[model samples]
Target: MSDSTDNTTFDSEDLNFDDFQLEDFKYEAPFQPAPEVQRDLSFFKSIPVTVTLEVASKEIALGDLMKAGEGTVIELDKLNGEPLDVKVNGSLMGHAEVVVVNEKYGLRLVDVLDSALTGVGH
Candidate 1:
């Protein structure tokens, strides 16, 4: 057999396929599932996953980063009042907004990710 992009040529007379056999095959044993394999998925349900909420990020020079003080402020790439990204296990799951819940800061979900079809959190 040859590919379309190949430039090499072969001599058909040098090939010999007359000695091939088809009836000599035999099965040694029947196929079976392993003893440790189980249909239950209880073990996967107990696993822990990390959930994270991102606010903003910025990159600055090393010299500028070294001159930081208690009153110093570094500007981020994201603007204020933008929706925050909610990630699960390092993947983007959805977006949310900051809310006040009984004097405590909380995240109110604005969108939920659907990963059933594409298998991607984003």
Candidate 2:
């Protein structure tokens, strides 16, 4: 390479924000919808994501937690037959119910979270 200096360096002070607008800086999805009115979200389809079904949560005293054993029973906030919260990558995705298929425990989707709430596309 010649003795030319590189201008690729990034400096926050070098940016001009005089014409910037909050709307112009809003986030947008990387993909677009299909022509058939379907969402073409195959961009990150192959990426693995962690899914968790939250049954319930309860806050117990430290003494009670320390005294818990194999036979110990703890109460949760949710009642029996209540729907469980389905989380994707630690974000609330939807609500589901426990189901048994092929002798395997699974979750049956009950309701999907709204796109607006999940920030799925907007």
Candidate 3:
């Protein structure tokens, strides 16, 4: 007898492909919480509120503005060395000084203006 193995009977039909049914491959989604979950509001009672500053400005005549060439001064509502007005939602809220923090420039709140009215529109 010669010492050789001739096993060539393996083919696609030999495997049981019908065992993998469509229902076995179906995916089941995980549970999710309802959209209308109630949340507690007591934590927001002590939150600090602040006002912002907004500068009221106007545009000068085009002829007057264009005449502003070299060394010509164009005046702004604010004066020199005065802290820039800080406004929130188009209303003056406070004043701040320009400061540098962590290699980046930011505003340092210096003063907060008192509201004109006690309870009504500010």
Best model number under TM-score: 2
- Badly placed stretches (over 4 Å) of model 2 are 1-41, 116-122
If both were scored by lDDT, which would come out higher, candidate 1 or candidate 3?
A: 1
True-structure lDDT of candidate 3: 0.70
List lDDT for all candidates, in order. 0.80, 0.85, 0.70
- List residue ranges in candidate 3 displaced over 4 A: 1-59, 68-72, 115-122
| lDDT score, candidate 2, position 99 | 91
What is candidate 1's lDDT per residue for 53-80, written digit by digit as tens?
A: 8998888998998999899999998888
What are the TM-scores, per candidate, against the unseen true structure? 0.56, 0.59, 0.41
Q: What's the lDDT of the predicted structure labeled candidate 1?
A: 0.80
Give me the runs in candidate 1 sitting further than 4 Å from their true place.
Answer: 1-43, 114-122
Give per-residue CA lDDT, model 2, range 23-114, as digits (tens).
76778788976677657666656678899999999998999899999988898999899899999888888989999999999999999988
Look at candidate 1 and give me any clashing residue pairs: none
Q: Which ten residues in a row have the lowest lDDT in candidate 3?
A: 113-122
How big is the positional error of residue 38 in model 3, measured in Å on the Cα after superposition?
16
